[model samples]
Target: MRRILLGAAMAAMLAAGGVAPAFAQGNPFQPLVYVNDSVVTRYELDQRMRFLQILRAPDGDRASAEQALIDDRLRLFAARQMGIAASDAQIDAGLAEFAGRANMDVEEFTRALAQAGVEQQTFRDFIAAGVVWRELVRQRLVPQVQVSDAELDQEMQRVIETPRITHVALSELIIPAPPGQEAQAMRLAESLVQSVRSEADFAAAARQHSATPSAENGGRLPWAPLENLPPSLRPIILSMQNGQISQPLTVEGAVVLFYLRDSRGTLRPGAKEQVLDYVRFRLASTAEANRIAALSDTCADLFVHARNLPPEQIQRQTLSQGQIPTAEAIRLAVLDDNESTIVSQGGSAEILMLCKRQSALLAGNAQEAPVPVTAEGEEGAAPDPDALPDREQMRGQIFSRKVGQAADNYLAELRANAIIRRP
Candidate 1:
């Protein structure tokens, strides 16, 4: 029954020119290998290799293609044995989502693939295999994973002890556009971006036209860890050479620009270590997110708003700079304690607030440490360990690691026990 369905699928693919003209002279349906009772066809291998090549995968060669197909077969077989299958709707959604990554719809993506001699079924099968295998893994292995508080504490300690590897120094210029002058602001920013050539030039422009408080310091910012910048801005900052100006970036009611003064490895000797305490509030609507942000001045204040909500929707954590996710780290970096920013992601909005920032030297380090200060420059208090936020983030990380290891072990076991043959 499976062979019959496979043959029909391959026949449709062949009719649609799944195999390139170069392979048309031979029987593309010939079996090259088998996983248990499942066959991996020559036509399938060719399609996969072509697809990988279109994706610019480094290992798009024949050996990689064959192994990938064999693994796909094993995954599908395992899924079937576990009575797990991807529905047509799920597969279609996956295809659409995958295509969206390349900024194309599924039909357009398929057309592009066809132009490169890969069939639509090749893409569909690939997504379906992944979807089914993920479901299988979740059901079979995810339930057994656990991360204890001890592990979380150790991970937190390790993150704090790890020194940041890279930091960037930057200057900024922000041009405020009162309700009606956005275009004028952007044009002015663009002109400055083109004219600015050196740190001195940037400083002059920043001191003259920038609205940010740093303008008084010639818009110069203290050296910041690369991870501390917004995820979207990090790559752009890294790509700039020293003394290069950035293209104008539009922010709410303003146009902003940055000048890269320097990027360096490690901090200058005796730099104070920075730690963050922040809260994340995930809400279904921007209005709700705004309301919560307005109502809360401290991380603890958010608990009132979260009382009726799911525990997962609101999180407060104290973490070293390296422990925060890049995107959140970027947002938190710019926020003053008790100030919040609403970020929209995937049909929901997150209100991220910085509750406190503490700067301290590692214990026993020879360099004298500066007194820890909050975002407002007041002496900061020690974070209460008992009041630490839920450990869901750390728990999720440990769960992912365990699930990945389990998946690899499970696949290996399946491969060892299965009857795999190459012709």
Candidate 2:
């Protein structure tokens, strides 16, 4: 990343050399752009110029496109060979379907495509690549994949039932370190943290010192879901009160001093374990692929026999996916470790699962929380009109989420096989 950016910055500097009044310059071919392997060809440069003339790109937009193309070429060269390739028919079908879905007539779609500099053929290739890659992932990778029922149930419970949460947002100004400047950077970081702690108001100090673009917003960062923050940042946030500030945290390349402004988020608050209880068992990594598969297969068998088990037997026998052989593999394979669980009694794989022993208790009446109960008896707090989601919307959210998870897990497998060359 540094190599790419530093090279670009250097290129930008070289490009600036030509800025000495174009009107006063004698006609000469300047070194317009350079890549590691070769300079941009005159023919290529002329083609871009012609494209600019015809397309009427904004000032420096053509240059931006050229630089982007160079970057793309470099990336392609550095990436491993792909076995994934979409067929012509598939690409065509996908394009047609997408255009139709967007409610654009053929001509209108064609015009819109031209405006975006997007060719139908290129779009087709992109879709085809995805189809091919997905197939590759399923074949060479996904067969080895397993999803622990334990993880799945855990996630589903978390999502379907969210905790009410609150947060305080903050922006921080970091002092940058030059090459061989670590000592100086630390000194600056310590000084900055101290000054922010002692002197002026957080907002004032933030505006004066923070290098982040949000300085004008008084160092106030946009509210983010707790999960969106870096894992290291999470505990600190959790430990904070409504309007408290934090000490300096060492982030990569810089020190961060954060001040909490305000936050609102889903807070799990806590739960009374019930019949629907989902337990999470963090697994150990061993004999990855085969072990996980065996665990999964075993869990499936146990789940089939769960109804026959006695109460005590069920509690003792059912194991989470994470507990079994290849437990980590089981977590990765099932793809929804947080939402699913496997349960069984008196089975060998039974104790391997992260079991959610849903106690024989119900949430509504026995230890009732004041929540609205549906006619079919799903207990939840009724929305206060302003807070409620429409029925269709709620359904859509779940569906979209399921679809998204499938896509992500599919991609993750492919990424594991990919060979990335940094240089």
Reference-based lDDT, residue 408, model 2: 62
Score residue 21 of candidate 2 by CA lDDT.
Answer: 20
lDDT tens digits by residue: candidate 2, 284-338: 2333222444545333443444545444433323333334446533543443322
Candidate 1, superposed: residue stretches over 4 Å from native: 1-25, 166-390
* Candidate 2 error regions (>4 Å): 1-85, 105-107, 116-118, 164-270, 274-423
Clashes of 1: 0
TM per candidate = 0.48, 0.32
Model 2 residue 400 distance off true place after TM-score fit, in angstroms: 10
Name the 10 consecutive residues with the lowest summed lDDT in model 1: 1-10
All candidates' lDDT scores?
Answer: 0.76, 0.45
Clash number for each model: 0, 40
The most accurate candidate by TM-score is: 1
